[model samples]
Target: MAKDRYAPKTLDDLMANMSSRMSSYVGKSQQLNQHQELLTQCVGATMAQKCRISNYRDSILVIEAESAAVAMRLNYMKMSILSDLRKNGLADLCQIKIQTSPRAAADQQAQKKRSEPIHNSRILSQQTADALLEVAEHAPASLKTKLEKLAALSKKNK
Candidate 1:
Protein backbone atom coordinates (compact mmCIF):
# COMPACT_ATOMS: atom_id res chain seq x y z
CA MET A 1 0.00 0.00 0.00
CA ALA A 2 1.21 3.49 -0.87
CA LYS A 3 1.17 6.32 1.70
CA ASP A 4 -1.25 9.18 1.17
CA ARG A 5 0.61 12.41 0.29
CA TYR A 6 -2.34 14.73 0.98
CA ALA A 7 -3.25 13.57 4.48
CA PRO A 8 -4.39 16.17 7.00
CA LYS A 9 -1.92 16.98 9.74
CA THR A 10 -2.61 17.84 13.40
CA LEU A 11 -2.38 21.49 14.44
CA ASP A 12 0.41 20.66 16.89
CA ASP A 13 2.46 19.13 14.08
CA LEU A 14 1.93 22.18 11.88
CA MET A 15 2.86 24.56 14.71
CA ALA A 16 5.95 22.56 15.54
CA ASN A 17 7.10 22.80 11.93
CA MET A 18 6.47 26.50 11.75
CA SER A 19 7.83 27.40 15.20
CA SER A 20 11.46 27.72 14.11
CA ARG A 21 10.58 30.01 11.21
CA MET A 22 8.20 32.14 13.31
CA SER A 23 10.10 32.23 16.60
CA SER A 24 11.75 35.62 16.10
CA TYR A 25 8.53 37.27 14.93
CA VAL A 26 6.63 35.80 17.88
CA GLY A 27 9.28 36.97 20.34
CA LYS A 28 9.24 40.47 18.90
CA SER A 29 5.44 40.58 19.12
CA GLN A 30 5.54 39.54 22.78
CA GLN A 31 8.15 42.17 23.56
CA LEU A 32 6.01 44.84 21.89
CA ASN A 33 2.96 43.68 23.86
CA GLN A 34 4.88 43.94 27.12
CA HIS A 35 5.97 47.44 26.21
CA GLN A 36 2.40 48.37 25.36
CA GLU A 37 1.14 47.09 28.72
CA LEU A 38 3.85 48.99 30.57
CA LEU A 39 2.90 52.13 28.66
CA THR A 40 -0.77 51.64 29.54
CA GLN A 41 0.09 51.33 33.20
CA CYS A 42 2.21 54.47 33.10
CA VAL A 43 -0.35 56.58 31.24
CA GLY A 44 -3.57 55.32 32.93
CA ALA A 45 -6.45 53.43 31.35
CA THR A 46 -8.21 56.31 29.56
CA MET A 47 -5.14 57.66 27.76
CA ALA A 48 -3.74 54.20 27.11
CA GLN A 49 -6.93 53.15 25.37
CA LYS A 50 -6.52 56.01 22.91
CA CYS A 51 -2.98 55.18 21.82
CA ARG A 52 -0.91 52.14 20.92
CA ILE A 53 2.77 51.24 20.72
CA SER A 54 3.62 51.08 17.02
CA ASN A 55 7.24 50.04 17.20
CA TYR A 56 10.47 50.08 19.17
CA ARG A 57 13.88 50.23 17.46
CA ASP A 58 17.33 51.70 18.13
CA SER A 59 16.20 52.95 21.54
CA ILE A 60 13.31 54.83 19.94
CA LEU A 61 9.75 54.02 20.95
CA VAL A 62 7.05 54.95 18.44
CA ILE A 63 3.48 55.49 19.52
CA GLU A 64 0.42 55.96 17.30
CA ALA A 65 -2.40 58.05 18.75
CA GLU A 66 -5.99 58.02 17.53
CA SER A 67 -5.93 61.77 16.90
CA ALA A 68 -3.77 64.88 17.08
CA ALA A 69 -5.21 65.77 20.48
CA VAL A 70 -4.14 62.42 21.82
CA ALA A 71 -0.71 62.79 20.26
CA MET A 72 -0.30 66.21 21.89
CA ARG A 73 -1.27 64.75 25.23
CA LEU A 74 1.28 61.97 24.79
CA ASN A 75 3.96 64.50 23.86
CA TYR A 76 3.28 66.38 27.10
CA MET A 77 3.94 63.20 29.08
CA LYS A 78 6.88 61.99 27.00
CA MET A 79 9.57 62.76 29.55
CA SER A 80 7.76 61.12 32.42
CA ILE A 81 6.88 58.14 30.23
CA LEU A 82 10.48 57.77 29.10
CA SER A 83 11.77 57.77 32.68
CA ASP A 84 9.07 55.32 33.68
CA LEU A 85 10.01 53.00 30.85
CA ARG A 86 13.67 53.19 31.83
CA LYS A 87 12.90 52.33 35.44
CA ASN A 88 10.66 49.49 34.34
CA GLY A 89 13.36 47.60 32.34
CA LEU A 90 13.68 49.54 29.10
CA ALA A 91 16.82 51.24 30.33
CA ASP A 92 18.25 51.86 26.87
CA LEU A 93 15.16 53.62 25.52
CA CYS A 94 16.28 57.08 24.44
CA GLN A 95 13.35 58.81 22.76
CA ILE A 96 9.56 58.61 22.51
CA LYS A 97 7.81 59.54 19.27
CA ILE A 98 4.08 60.23 18.98
CA GLN A 99 2.19 60.22 15.70
CA THR A 100 -1.45 60.87 14.95
CA SER A 101 -3.13 58.18 12.86
CA PRO A 102 -6.70 58.71 11.67
CA ARG A 103 -6.87 55.00 10.91
CA ALA A 104 -6.42 54.30 14.59
CA ALA A 105 -9.57 56.29 15.32
CA ALA A 106 -11.47 54.34 12.68
CA ASP A 107 -10.24 51.06 14.14
CA GLN A 108 -11.30 52.15 17.62
CA GLN A 109 -14.73 53.09 16.32
CA ALA A 110 -15.08 49.68 14.64
CA GLN A 111 -14.09 47.93 17.85
CA LYS A 112 -16.62 49.96 19.82
CA LYS A 113 -19.31 49.05 17.30
CA ARG A 114 -18.47 45.36 17.58
CA SER A 115 -18.49 45.46 21.37
CA GLU A 116 -21.70 47.45 21.78
CA PRO A 117 -24.92 45.51 22.18
CA ILE A 118 -27.52 45.86 19.40
CA HIS A 119 -30.93 46.87 20.72
CA ASN A 120 -34.04 45.82 18.78
CA SER A 121 -37.15 47.74 19.79
CA ARG A 122 -39.79 45.09 19.33
CA ILE A 123 -43.45 45.91 19.92
CA LEU A 124 -45.55 43.52 21.98
CA SER A 125 -48.25 41.53 20.16
CA GLN A 126 -51.91 41.80 21.12
CA GLN A 127 -51.92 38.15 22.21
CA THR A 128 -49.00 38.73 24.63
CA ALA A 129 -50.66 41.85 26.06
CA ASP A 130 -53.90 39.98 26.64
CA ALA A 131 -52.05 37.10 28.33
CA LEU A 132 -50.20 39.56 30.52
CA LEU A 133 -53.50 41.23 31.52
CA GLU A 134 -55.00 37.86 32.35
CA VAL A 135 -52.02 36.95 34.54
CA ALA A 136 -52.08 40.38 36.17
CA GLU A 137 -55.62 39.81 37.38
CA HIS A 138 -54.50 36.82 39.46
CA ALA A 139 -51.04 38.14 40.43
CA PRO A 140 -50.29 39.71 43.86
CA ALA A 141 -51.20 43.36 44.25
CA SER A 142 -47.66 44.70 43.75
CA LEU A 143 -46.92 42.38 40.78
CA LYS A 144 -50.43 42.92 39.37
CA THR A 145 -49.90 46.67 39.27
CA LYS A 146 -46.53 46.26 37.54
CA LEU A 147 -47.93 43.74 35.06
CA GLU A 148 -50.86 46.01 34.28
CA LYS A 149 -48.48 48.89 33.68
CA LEU A 150 -46.40 46.73 31.31
CA ALA A 151 -49.51 45.61 29.40
CA ALA A 152 -50.68 49.19 29.11
CA LEU A 153 -47.29 50.33 27.87
CA SER A 154 -47.36 47.57 25.25
CA LYS A 155 -50.74 48.82 24.00
CA LYS A 156 -49.38 52.38 23.68
CA ASN A 157 -46.69 51.09 21.29
CA LYS A 158 -49.41 50.17 18.81
Candidate 2:
Protein backbone atom coordinates (compact mmCIF):
# COMPACT_ATOMS: atom_id res chain seq x y z
CA MET A 1 0.00 0.00 0.00
CA ALA A 2 1.28 3.52 -0.83
CA LYS A 3 1.95 5.95 1.99
CA ASP A 4 -0.35 8.98 2.34
CA ARG A 5 1.43 12.02 0.81
CA TYR A 6 -0.15 14.46 3.28
CA ALA A 7 0.67 12.39 6.35
CA PRO A 8 3.23 13.74 8.85
CA LYS A 9 6.72 12.31 8.47
CA THR A 10 9.60 11.49 10.81
CA LEU A 11 11.44 14.37 12.52
CA ASP A 12 14.46 14.05 10.23
CA ASP A 13 12.29 14.07 7.11
CA LEU A 14 10.39 17.14 8.32
CA MET A 15 13.64 18.94 9.17
CA ALA A 16 15.10 18.15 5.74
CA ASN A 17 12.05 19.60 4.01
CA MET A 18 12.18 22.71 6.17
CA SER A 19 15.91 23.08 5.45
CA SER A 20 15.28 22.94 1.73
CA ARG A 21 12.54 25.54 2.03
CA MET A 22 14.92 27.84 3.94
CA SER A 23 17.78 27.52 1.45
CA SER A 24 17.02 30.93 -0.10
CA TYR A 25 17.18 32.62 3.29
CA VAL A 26 20.64 31.12 3.94
CA GLY A 27 22.24 33.33 1.27
CA LYS A 28 20.90 36.53 2.81
CA SER A 29 21.98 35.31 6.24
CA GLN A 30 25.51 34.75 4.95
CA GLN A 31 25.56 38.23 3.44
CA LEU A 32 24.49 39.71 6.76
CA ASN A 33 27.25 37.78 8.57
CA GLN A 34 29.77 39.04 6.03
CA HIS A 35 28.58 42.59 6.49
CA GLN A 36 28.95 42.29 10.27
CA GLU A 37 32.51 40.94 9.98
CA LEU A 38 33.47 43.61 7.47
CA LEU A 39 31.97 46.31 9.66
CA THR A 40 33.96 45.06 12.64
CA GLN A 41 37.19 45.06 10.65
CA CYS A 42 36.55 48.57 9.36
CA VAL A 43 35.73 49.98 12.78
CA GLY A 44 38.61 48.35 14.71
CA ALA A 45 38.50 45.87 17.60
CA THR A 46 37.72 48.10 20.61
CA MET A 47 34.73 49.92 19.13
CA ALA A 48 33.49 46.95 17.11
CA GLN A 49 33.31 44.73 20.19
CA LYS A 50 30.85 47.16 21.82
CA CYS A 51 28.73 47.44 18.68
CA ARG A 52 26.83 44.78 16.75
CA ILE A 53 24.71 44.62 13.62
CA SER A 54 21.13 44.47 14.88
CA ASN A 55 19.46 44.58 11.48
CA TYR A 56 20.14 45.02 7.79
CA ARG A 57 17.36 46.02 5.42
CA ASP A 58 16.70 48.33 2.48
CA SER A 59 20.24 49.72 2.26
CA ILE A 60 20.34 50.45 5.99
CA LEU A 61 22.42 48.76 8.68
CA VAL A 62 21.18 49.23 12.24
CA ILE A 63 24.01 48.98 14.76
CA GLU A 64 23.35 48.52 18.48
CA ALA A 65 25.91 50.06 20.77
CA GLU A 66 26.49 49.42 24.48
CA SER A 67 25.85 53.06 25.43
CA ALA A 68 24.82 56.42 24.01
CA ALA A 69 28.43 57.55 23.95
CA VAL A 70 29.40 54.56 21.84
CA ALA A 71 26.37 55.12 19.64
CA MET A 72 27.34 58.76 19.10
CA ARG A 73 30.90 57.72 18.24
CA LEU A 74 29.63 55.15 15.74
CA ASN A 75 27.31 57.77 14.26
CA TYR A 76 30.39 59.85 13.47
CA MET A 77 31.92 56.86 11.71
CA LYS A 78 28.74 56.16 9.73
CA MET A 79 29.99 57.56 6.42
CA SER A 80 33.36 55.84 6.73
CA ILE A 81 31.65 52.56 7.54
CA LEU A 82 29.33 52.92 4.57
CA SER A 83 32.29 53.57 2.23
CA ASP A 84 34.08 50.46 3.50
CA LEU A 85 30.95 48.31 3.03
CA ARG A 86 30.46 49.72 -0.49
CA LYS A 87 34.07 48.93 -1.31
CA ASN A 88 33.52 45.35 -0.21
CA GLY A 89 30.67 44.98 -2.75
CA LEU A 90 27.80 45.64 -0.36
CA ALA A 91 26.89 48.78 -2.27
CA ASP A 92 23.33 48.50 -1.01
CA LEU A 93 24.64 49.30 2.45
CA CYS A 94 24.12 53.01 2.01
CA GLN A 95 23.02 54.07 5.51
CA ILE A 96 24.31 53.27 8.99
CA LYS A 97 22.29 53.72 12.18
CA ILE A 98 23.59 53.64 15.75
CA GLN A 99 21.24 52.81 18.58
CA THR A 100 21.99 52.65 22.30
CA SER A 101 20.92 49.35 23.82
CA PRO A 102 20.67 48.58 27.56
CA ARG A 103 21.11 44.86 26.92
CA ALA A 104 24.91 45.11 26.87
CA ALA A 105 24.94 47.07 30.12
CA ALA A 106 22.68 44.55 31.82
CA ASP A 107 24.83 41.66 30.58
CA GLN A 108 27.94 43.38 31.91
CA GLN A 109 26.27 43.86 35.29
CA ALA A 110 25.20 40.22 35.35
CA GLN A 111 28.71 39.10 34.44
CA LYS A 112 30.18 41.23 37.20
CA LYS A 113 27.74 39.76 39.69
CA ARG A 114 28.62 36.24 38.57
CA SER A 115 32.36 36.88 38.84
CA GLU A 116 32.13 38.53 42.26
CA PRO A 117 32.81 36.57 45.42
CA ILE A 118 29.62 36.00 47.31
CA HIS A 119 29.47 37.26 50.89
CA ASN A 120 28.52 34.49 53.28
CA SER A 121 26.15 35.58 56.04
CA ARG A 122 28.76 35.87 58.75
CA ILE A 123 28.17 35.25 62.46
CA LEU A 124 29.93 37.86 64.53
CA SER A 125 32.87 36.72 66.65
CA GLN A 126 32.57 36.82 70.46
CA GLN A 127 34.95 39.79 70.70
CA THR A 128 33.11 41.68 67.94
CA ALA A 129 29.75 40.89 69.55
CA ASP A 130 30.96 42.17 72.89
CA ALA A 131 32.22 45.33 71.19
CA LEU A 132 28.89 45.85 69.44
CA LEU A 133 27.00 45.35 72.74
CA GLU A 134 29.26 47.87 74.51
CA VAL A 135 28.86 50.38 71.69
CA ALA A 136 25.12 49.83 71.50
CA GLU A 137 24.64 51.14 75.08
CA HIS A 138 25.75 54.68 74.01
CA ALA A 139 24.55 54.38 70.39
CA PRO A 140 21.34 56.09 69.24
CA ALA A 141 18.24 53.87 69.07
CA SER A 142 18.54 53.83 65.27
CA LEU A 143 22.00 52.19 65.53
CA LYS A 144 21.03 49.98 68.48
CA THR A 145 18.83 47.65 66.43
CA LYS A 146 21.64 46.78 64.02
CA LEU A 147 24.17 46.23 66.80
CA GLU A 148 21.71 44.10 68.76
CA LYS A 149 21.08 41.95 65.67
CA LEU A 150 24.82 41.34 65.23
CA ALA A 151 25.17 40.55 68.98
CA ALA A 152 22.25 38.13 68.74
CA LEU A 153 23.84 36.47 65.67
CA SER A 154 27.10 35.95 67.63
CA LYS A 155 25.22 34.43 70.59
CA LYS A 156 23.29 32.09 68.34
CA ASN A 157 26.50 30.81 66.76
CA LYS A 158 28.06 29.98 70.19
Cα RMSD, each candidate:
9.2, 7.2
**Native-referenced Cα lDDT, model 2:** 0.85
Candidate 1 regions exceeding 4 Å error are 1-18, 121-158
Q: Least accurate stretch of 10 residues (summed lDDT) in model 2?
A: 24-33
Worst 10 residues of 1 by lDDT: 149-158
Model 2 Cα RMSD, Å? 7.2
Model 2 Cα shift for residue 89 (angstroms): 2.2
TM-scores of all candidate predictions against the true structure: 0.64, 0.55
lDDT of 2 by residue, 1-158 (tens): 99899998899998899898798588777877877799888999888878878788888888889999989898888888889889987876778888899797678669989999998777679999889999999999989998898798887887
Q: Which pairs in model 1 have colliding backbones?
A: none
* Model 1 CA RMSD to the hidden true structure, in angstroms: 9.2
lDDT of 1 by residue, 1-158 (tens): 98787998889999997997699889889999999999998999999989999899999999999989999999999999999999998999999999999898898899999999998698888888899999999999999999888888777987
